[model samples]
Each structure stands twice: as structure tokens, then as C-alpha cells.
Target: MKIEVRDVVKSYKHKTVLKNITFTMEGPKIIGFLGHNGAGKTTFLNLLAGLIATTDGTILVNGDNVFNTPSTLRDICFIAESGNFQEEMTIAQALKANSFFYPKWDEQLAQRLLQVFALNPKEKVRSLSKGMVSALGIITGFASNAAITIFDEPYIGLDVAARSMFYDLLIDQQIDNPRLYILSTHLIDEASELFEEIFILQEGQLLLQKTTDEWHKHIVAVKGNATDVAAAIVDLEIIDQHMFMQEMTAIVHTGGHPIEGYNVTLESVSLQDMLVYLSKQKARSGK
Candidate 1:
């Protein structure tokens, strides 16, 4: 499967949610869609899933416009945190309805997941707990076997144990049936290892897109005396800096080279820290 977003823009009542976002993702891989609150992550996903129309530009799935296209829509499955189902509909009925839209829907896998999540198939949608709802969404996403499957904060009310189980099941499903999976979540540290690549959005813009390994290689943190830290990072792209007393910590793009002879200690930056520092840098620079 191939997805292409070109100069895409989304707006509501004159307020832009996403601006000139462009990227291309092809084949089967797990991608992390990350951002702070109101950074347009969910809005971008909605555009891809054709839940909402783009205000400008275009989005194509396998060279076809995704908006209101039945053929392409059938190959795409989007499971959000809060699923919308008929209040009186039973879990079994909802799953059956979903199967009609997706050609590769697996009833057996859905049944097994319902059992694993301890959800009663006969229970009405409104009667299930918050976690149970999330579980139901997970079952739908995994069983759909769509060419493009997207999960937008799909573990909202799940406990630690249940979330762990979901992750495990997701890995197993990916291994057995490879497909394009785009996951958007606030639980970065927990789900970071699952992503082969990451796309970061900030303030309605596509801030960065890089493979997990490339991200690790490019971002570095250095700590030392203020002068030494600045000297060591000279000519490099510095994302953020902070000083406590005489010591200073700097986040920089190292270009994959060790900085030596400046009495500075270089360390790999965590994904969370990198996001924080980059956001701060953007803010400080009025970007």
C-alpha cells in the first residue's frame, strides 16, 4: 500500500489545523504519529481515513483519492479511541456490520479477541465499560486486515495489563499479516520501540519525519560547563539549552560524530526529551 499527502491543509471556521503537510509512506510498516495536544495529529489521521475532507491539496491511497472513494475506503480501517456504534447494538452485531465494509475481515480473530478482552458478545454497546469499548475497537482494527490500518489513541481507558496485552497482540498480528499500520498515541516511551519510523507534528506543521534509528543517530544531549557546552556544539544544530548554576545541558544534532576535547559528556537523547527540546526550541524561536 502507498499513501501520499501533498500540500494538505485542514481548517475549521478559519482556524487551520494542519498546514501544507506533505509526505509519502509505502509498503508495510508500523509508523508512529506523534505530537503534543492540538498539534494536528488526529486531524491529519482523519484526513487520511477520509473521515474529513481536506481544505486544500490532495491525499491519495494507491494513486486514488481517498475521500468518498469506496474502493480505497474498503482497504482502509481507522479505529479511534472512542468508537461510534448504535447504542442498542450488541457487540456481535457491530462486528458483523464492520465485516461488510472490509473484504479481509476475520470473524475468527475477532471472536478470539473478544474472549481475550473478556467482552461478552451479547452485551449492548452502551453497557460496556470504557476499557471494554477500547478493547472492542482493538478487535475491529486487528481483524479488519485492511491494507491500511490506523489506530488513534486506541487504548484510552485500558489498564496497564490490558494495554500490554494489546501491544503483544498487535505485534503478533503484524508478524503474521504484514500491513501498513499508523499508530498515534501519547504513550511515546511505551510504544516507541514498536515504530520503524516516526512523524512528528507541531503547531499544524509536519515538524520532522525520520526512522527510529535515524532519529537516535541525529539527536544528542551534551552536558558540561556553559562555555564548554557551547564551544563543543559550535557549528552544530542546537535544539535547546538550559543552565543550572554553572552547568549547562544542550540538545544538539551531532551528525553522528562524537564531540571530544571540550570537557563535555555526550549522551543519546530519549524520544520524549527530543520532542520536548524541539518544541521548546520552536517556541523560543517564534517558529
Candidate 2:
């Protein structure tokens, strides 16, 4: 599957959520769609799922307009946080009902995952806790076998162990049946390794698209004397800086090259931290 967003804009009244955002992604890979709160991650995903209309521009999933396009819609399964399954329906009933929407539904996988996730098929959806609901959503997403599967912070009430299980499932599913899996998440440090490619948004604008490695490659932290930190990053892009007595710490973009020495210590920044700094950067001084 191929998804293309060309100059997309989404607005509500006078406020714009996504501003002329544009990007493309292909299938058979795990994609990380990342941003901070109010970065329009959810809004963008809603547009991709055809749940809402774009105020301007277009979004195409496999060369077909996703909005009102049943063909495209059937191939894309979006599982968001909370309220996924009907409150009145039993686990089995809900699966039986939703499976009909996907032509490539994997019944055996669905049944087996019920056991893997420790969910009883006969259990009522309303009785299950938040974590259980998230597990059901995860199961449905995988078993749908859709060309594009989206998980928008679906692990809301899940614990560390459960989230790790979901991460393992992502790798397992990719190996067995290669397809597109777009994951929008805030647990960047934990799931950073799962991303083959990533798109980041900041303050209603698209930030950058890069491989996970590329996202972390040039970002470094230099700490030492203020003069040494300044000298070390004089030629590099300084993302942010902090002063502490005589010494200082600065996050720098090293232009993809290793910095040898300048009386400072160079340390690798976490993927989540790097992204935070990246988002703080503006395209044109915040206009």
C-alpha cells in the first residue's frame, strides 16, 4: 500500500490543526508517526482514515481518495485509544461482526490471539477493563489483515509488560505478513527501534521524515565549560543550551559528522529527546 498526502490542511473554525502537511509512505514497513500534544497527530490520522474531511489538499491511499472510498477504507484499519468495541457486545460477537468489513480477515489468528492476550471470548466488552479493551483492539487490527493498520496510542491503559507484548507483536506480524503499520505514539524511547521510517509534526506543521537512525544520527549533547561547549558547537546546529555555573550543556546537531574534541564531552541523546528538540525548531521563526 502507498499513502500520499499532498498539501493537506485541516482546520476548525479559526484554528488550523494541520497546515499544508504533505508526505508519502509505502507498505511492508513499520512507520512511526510522531508529535507532541497539539502537533495534529490525531487530526492527521483521522484524515487518513477518512473519519473527517480535509479543509484543503488531498490524501490518497494507494492512489485512491480515502474519504468515502469503501475500497480504500476496507484496506485500512485504524485502532485508536478507548471505546473501540461496543459496550453491549461480547468479545466474540464484536469480532464476528467487525470481521465482515475486512475481506482478508484472519479468523484463526483472531481466535488464537484471544488466548494470547488472555481474553475470554464470552466476556462482555463492558465488563473488561481499559487494558482488556486495548488488547481487543490490538487483536482486531492484526487479524483484519488490512493493507494499512494504524494504532493511535491504543495502549492507553496497558502496562509496561503489555505494551512490550504489543511491540513484539508488531515485529512478529511484519515478519509473517509484511504490510503497512502506522503507529502514532508518545512512547518514543521504548518503540524507537520498531520504526523503519518516521514522520514528525510540530505545532500544526510537518517537521521531518527520516529513518529512525537518521532521526538520532546527528543529535548529540556536549557538556563541559561554557566556552568549550560553545567552541564544540560553533559550526554545528545548536538545538538548545543550558548554563550551570561555569560549565554548560548544549544539544547540537553535528551535521552527521563525529566531533573529536574541544574540551567537551559528546554524548548521544535519546530518540525521544532528539525529537523534542527537533519539534522546538521552527521553519521560519514561527512566522
Candidate 3:
């Protein structure tokens, strides 16, 4: 699967959600779509699914305009935080409806997932709890098997055990039939292991796009006496930093070079921490 977003701009009245954003997603890979609230992650995903149009530029899926091409829309499946299925439909009915929308829909997988999620196919959507509703969305998304599957904060009401089950199912699906999966959530630590590449959107612009491995390699975290820390980061690109009376901690982009002689203690930065600092850096720079 190939999705090209060229100079894409999305606006609402006087405010813009995305500005001159351009990126290409070539799959089968699990990708993390991350940003703080209102950073335009949802708008970008909507563009991919052709649920909304851009103010300017284009989003192309396999060389076809995503907004106007019916075939391209069929290749993408999107499950939102809540209310994806008709409230009046039974679980079985919703699955049957989805089978018509997604040409690649797998009834066998859908049935299997019902067992996996402990959902009764006969249960009515309106009578189900919020967690059950989310389970339904998960079932449909996985069963759709669309070329590009997107989940936008899709586990809102799911319990820890249920969310873990979803993650395992997702990993299993990738192992058996790898495809493009774009997920956006605040549960970074829980989902970090599944991401191959990540796109960070900050204030409606593309902040960074790099593999999970590359992020760790290039963004270094260190702590030491203030003087030593300053020396260590003098020539490096500082992402974020904090200072106490006699000590300091800082994150920097090392350009993948080893900080051989610095008297600082090297630390591991979590994915969520990395994103937080990266966005802060972007905001400070007014970019």
C-alpha cells in the first residue's frame, strides 16, 4: 500500500488543522500517528480515509486522489473512538453491513474475533456497554483487512485486559498478514512495541518521521553536573532540558554519534517522553 500526501493543508474557517503537510506511507507496517490534542492527527487520518477534503494540495492513495476516488476509499478502513456501528444493528448485522463496505472483509475472521473478544454475535449494539461497543469496532477493523487500517483512540472504554487482547490480536494479524496499520492514542507505552515507524505532528505541521529504532539512536538522554551537561550538549541539538541547583538533565540529538568522553550518565528516553520533548522543541522554535 502506498499513500502520498503532498503539500496537504486542511483548514476550518480561519484556523488550519494541517499546514503544508506532506508525507508518504508505504506499507505493510505498523505506524504510530502521534501528537498532542488539536495537533491535527485526526484531520490527517480523515484525509487518508477520504472522510474530509483538504483546503489545498492532495492526498493520493496508490496514485488515485483519496478524496474523490471510490476505489481508494475502499482500500482504507477507519474506526473512531466510539459509535462506529449503527446503534440499532445487532453485532451480526453490523458485521454483515461491513462485509458489503470492505471488499476484502473476512467473515471467518469476524466470527473468530467475536470469540476472541467474548462478544455475542446476537447482542444488540444499543444494549451493549461502552467496552462492548469498542470491541465491536476492533472486530470490524481487524475483519475488514483493508490495505490501510486506522484506529483513532479506539480503545476508550476497553479494560486493561481487553486492550491487551486487542494488541495481541493486532500483532497476530501482522504476523500472518502484514498490512498498513496507523494507530493514534495516548497509550504510547502500551503500544510502543508494535510501532515500526512513527509520525509526530506538532501544531498542524509534520514534526518528525522516523523508525522507533532510529529515534532511540539519534535522541540521547543524559544527566550530570550542570557544567558537564552543558559541555556534553554544546555542539548537539538539544530537544529538552531541566536544571536544578547543581545538576542537570537534558535530551539531545547526537546525530547517532557516541558521547564517548562526556561525564554524564546516559539514560533511556521513553517514546512518549521523546514525543513530548520533540513537540516542546518545535513549539519553542515557533515552527
Candidate 4:
């Protein structure tokens, strides 16, 4: 599957939430849509899922406009933090309904996942806990087998153990049945390994998009004596810094410069820390 977003913009009233975002992705791979709160991650995802219309530009999945097009939408599945099921419907009934809509829906997979998550098929949607709701969404996303499956913070209210189980199941399912998966979340460290590419949104703009390996190559953390650390990164752009007594640590964008020979130790930056630094820098710069 291929998704193309070209100069897309979304606004509510007069305030724009997504600004001129443009990108194209192809093939079956896991993509991370990451950003701080209110960075328009959900808004963008909704646009792609056709839940909301774009204010400007276009979004195409497999060369067809997905908005209000049932033919194209049938191949797409979007599961939110909360499952969207009829309040009075039983889990079994909801799964049956989903099978009617999705051409590739797998009832066997749904049953297996329901058992794996310990959710009773006869339970009403309103009676499930928040974690169970998330589990239901997960099950729906996996079993739909849509060519394009998107998960927007689908692990909300899940405990650590349950979340781990979700990650394992996602990996296993992807291995067995490859499809395009877009996961939007703030748990960068835990889910970072699953993403082939990461897209970052900041203040309604697509701030950055890079492959995981490429992203790591552009930013690094350095720690050493305050003076040496400062000198080592003097020529580079510093995204963040910390000073404790005589020791200093700084996150710097290498920008193709060889960073060495300043008596400072350099290490790869964590995805979480890199994002924090980038967000802070953007805020400080008033961008």
C-alpha cells in the first residue's frame, strides 16, 4: 500500500491544526507518528483515515481519495485509543459487524485475540474497563487485515504487562501478515524499535521525517568537563544542554561534522531525549 499526503492542511474554525504537511510512504512497514500533546498527530491521522476532511490539498491511498469513498476506505482500518463500538452491542456482535465491512477480516484472529486479552465475547461494550476497550481496538485493528491499518494511541489505559503483550502480538502479526501500519504514540522508547521511519509534528507543522537509522546519525549527546563539552560542540547546533557542577552534557546536531578531539565523550542520543530536546529548542526559538 502507498499513502501520499500533499500539502495537506486541516483547520477548525480559524485555527489550523495541520499545516502544509506533505509526505509519501509505500510498502508494508511500521511507521511512528510522534509528537508532543496537541501537535496535531491525531488530527493528521483522522485526515488520512477519512474521519475528517482536509481543508486544503489532498491525501491518497493507493491512488484513490479515501475521504467518503467506501471502495477505498474498505481497505483501511483506523483504531483509536477507545474502541468505537455500539454501547449496547456485545463484543461478539461488534466483531461480526466488523467482518461485514472489512473484506479481509479474520474471525479466527479476532477470537484468538479476545482469548489472549481475556475479554469475554458476551460482554457489553459499556461494561469493559478502559484497558479492555483498548484491547478491543487492538483486536479489531489486527483482525481487520486492512491494507492500511492505523493505531492512534491504542494502548491507553493498558498496564505495563498488557502493553508488552500488545507489542509482542503486533510484531508477530506483522511477521505473519505484512501490511502498512501507522502507530501514533508518545511512548517513544518502548515502540521506537518497531518503526522503520519516524515522523515528528510540532505546533501544526511536520518538523521532521527520517528513517530510524538516519535520525540517529544526525543527533548525538556529549558529556565531559564543562569547558571541553562546550568547545567540542561550539561549531555545531546544540539542541539541549545540562550543566552539573564541572560536568556538562549537551545534545547537538552533528550536521555532517566529525565531533572529536575535545576531551569529551560522545554517545548516541535516545529517541525520547532527542525529541524532548528538539521540542524545547523549538519552543525557545519561538518557532
- Lowest lDDT 10-mer window, candidate 1? 278-287
All candidates: CA RMSD (Å)? 2.1, 3.0, 2.2, 2.2
Q: Which candidate achieves the best TM-score against the true structure?
A: 1
Per-residue lDDT tens digits of candidate 3, residues 53-145?
899999988899998999888889999877688988999999999999999999999998899889998989999998888889999999999
TM-score of 3: 0.92
**Residue 163 CA displacement from its true place in model 3, Å:** 1.0
For residues 2-57, write the lDDT of model 1, one tens digit per residue: 99999999989969999899999886999998987778988888888889999999
TM-score of each: 0.93, 0.89, 0.92, 0.91
Residues 1-287, candidate 2: write the lDDT tens digits.
89999999999997998999888999789999988777899898888988899999999987889996888999988998666789999999999987999999999999988998999999999999888999999999999999999999978788999999999988999999999999998899899889999887878887667776876777778999987777778778777787878779899767788777578887878769866676566433462
Cα lDDT, all candidates? 0.88, 0.87, 0.89, 0.88
List runs of model 1 lying over 4 Å from the truth: 254-261, 278-287
Leading candidate by lDDT: 3
How do the residues 1-287 of candidate 4 rate in per-residue lDDT, one tens digit apiece?
99999999998996999889899987698999888877888888888888899999899988888796778999889997664788799999999999999999999999999999999999999998888889999999999999889999998889999999989988998999999899998888999999998888888888777888877887788899988888898878777899888889998878867886779888998778877886786688775
Better of 3 and 4 by lDDT: 3
Candidate 2 achieves a global lDDT of 0.87
